[model samples]
Target: MQVIKKLKDFRTLELLQKANELTLKNHSNEITLERAIFLSWWCEKGDCAFCYMSTQKPRISDPKKARRQINSILAEAELCRRMGWNIEFLSGGYGSFSTSEIKSISQDIFKITKQPVWLNIGITNDLEEYGEEISGITGAIEIANPELHDKICPSKSLEDITNMLEVAGDLGFKKAITIILGLGETPDDLEYLFNLINDLKIHRVTFYSLNPHKDTIFETQPQPASLYYAGVVAATRIMFPELEIVCGTWIDNLANIGPLIMSGANGLTKFPLFKMFGTRYGKRVEEEVYWSGRKLKGTFTDFNSLKNGADLGELNPFIKRYIDKCLNKKPLKE
Candidate 1:
């Protein structure tokens, strides 16, 4: 399929406007933004060139430490619920936890709060038998181009990722896939991935702009232009009108939010509290205390206080501006 190649083309702008209208029409008045909690801090696939986790060693195994981490996540989930946000638990490290351990953790969380939980703990072959406590499964296929995937993630294969998605679908799990832009991938590569998504009946898609971490291989690489990112968001909506396209909150600049939403993204994934209080436990391979850190000095005291203090509400003005500009056909003043 022919795709939009240029970010500033007149045709691209028109399509973006159309997508914005479509999003408003389908979603009614409010866009559905979601929040997630990182179950752990590091990645098990420790060799991915673009990830900070790749620079670190795997976490050590300790039942006591694991229990504490689980408790912290549950506490945060409760806080998130009180904030009127349905929280998804993302397993940070790779699939270091065994199937039974994963299943038991999900069961524990669900039994306590009875809320939806999402898992992204890397590929586990026996996931289908891991029980239905999880609401969905997320597989981050960072780049659609096979060559790029192989180069950046030398530890994983595209085929394994595809099979994982297929297995998740076969087992009746809602599939959420992540596609990172500015990974040296072309529009055609995105089209190919979208086609695969359509074929697999994936439930949700989230877009992330490549943010090169300091210690990673791509640290010095320039981030993709905001306009290009916005263009991709618009094109994605045009291609999959009914699919839930999420704008990731990890984006550094708030200005990009307006153009991203205007280009038809209907969901935002954020975790301000998680960033403030969360701890990182790498995969099971090193010392238990090897990868643990946080910003605050005390225990989590108040959910409302933390939520209020966060800049999470910054998206509101951007959304309003995008809507006004769309309706009035006037350029939004930056």
Candidate 2:
């Protein structure tokens, strides 16, 4: 096992290359792409320093609007199913609703979609209350270090996050966690974070690069280097060989995708399938405005094409060497 003591060590391409080899050895060639829907941007606690939604207006008592939003989400889920993506994920801004509300929404969405669903509806103290209603739970512990987590996300405690994960695991739900890179956390901090995940037996992890929103507190902070982000992905693969490493393609640009996949990510998440299909959800102003200042646009193949054995049109050449080497298969020329 590779032991990295410094953050800079993760920036080394050679280390990333070695980690990529290890990832191929453990997991096969196929990359998994999962679909997700943003249920709501309303957070009740509203104290996370790094999130743009943290300072948004509180959730108003408007049942009509809420119902419309639910209908729109279901419509989007139906489109995703037609597109050949069956695993649907439902997520929202943290503390947006009560645990009971989340359960109700999950049950409704599951019933309407009739598909496997993963819930990322923020921290719920009683996750086991849902029982088999949810296929999995994503407990996002953005930063692992207690001090950093406290400083960055004051709304929730690390203890609470761990408790949620433990409860989800005990309930036999497929457990996953999301970790944001470049949140002022160190290599030791990451080591500590993964240790906790291993202890909790959480096997699936998603990594997001910190893309600061304009009005958020973290906006003034320097953006994380792309290479540094890729390094962290590679390092995570090296540290947890058996764990599934997922890259958040929504947060990073197209150029970084190759390096991220080559480094060790076996799955992609948070893709904008609805946006690609030209579905307008009416909340676009609020949603697009937050990610506006940053250059979030990029060119990538749709999930359906990749699922049907079609090569990534423009991206295949750049990543083919790594994919070929990892899969031990012949290379294809563009």
Q: Rate the local accuracy (lDDT) of all candidates.
A: 0.62, 0.64
Which pairs clash (backbone N, Cα, C closer than 3 Å) in model 2? none
Query: Ten residues in a row with the worst lDDT in model 1?
Result: 281-290
lDDT of candidate 2 over 1-334, digit per residue (tens): 3545534555458767777788878987655555667767666666777887665655455423433255455544544444445453677775555678767777765765575578887777677578556888888788867888888888777788778878887788878888887778876676787687788888788888777776777888776777877877877777788888877754336456667777787766665543433222212321332232212121122323223333434433533432232234222222
lDDT by residue (tens digit), candidate 1, 1-334: 4446543353667767877777776654344436666655555558888887776564544323433355555555544544444554456666445678777777866765576588877776877666658888888788878889889888878788778888988888888888888878876676678777888788788888888888877899887877778778887777777777877645245456567777877655543433322222101101111121111112212323323322224343533332232234322222
Q: What is the lDDT of residue 203 in candidate 1?
A: 78
Clashes of 1: 4
**Once model 1 is optimally superposed onto the true structure by TM-score, how far is the C-alpha of residue 284 displaced, in angstroms?**
38
Clashes of each: 4, 0
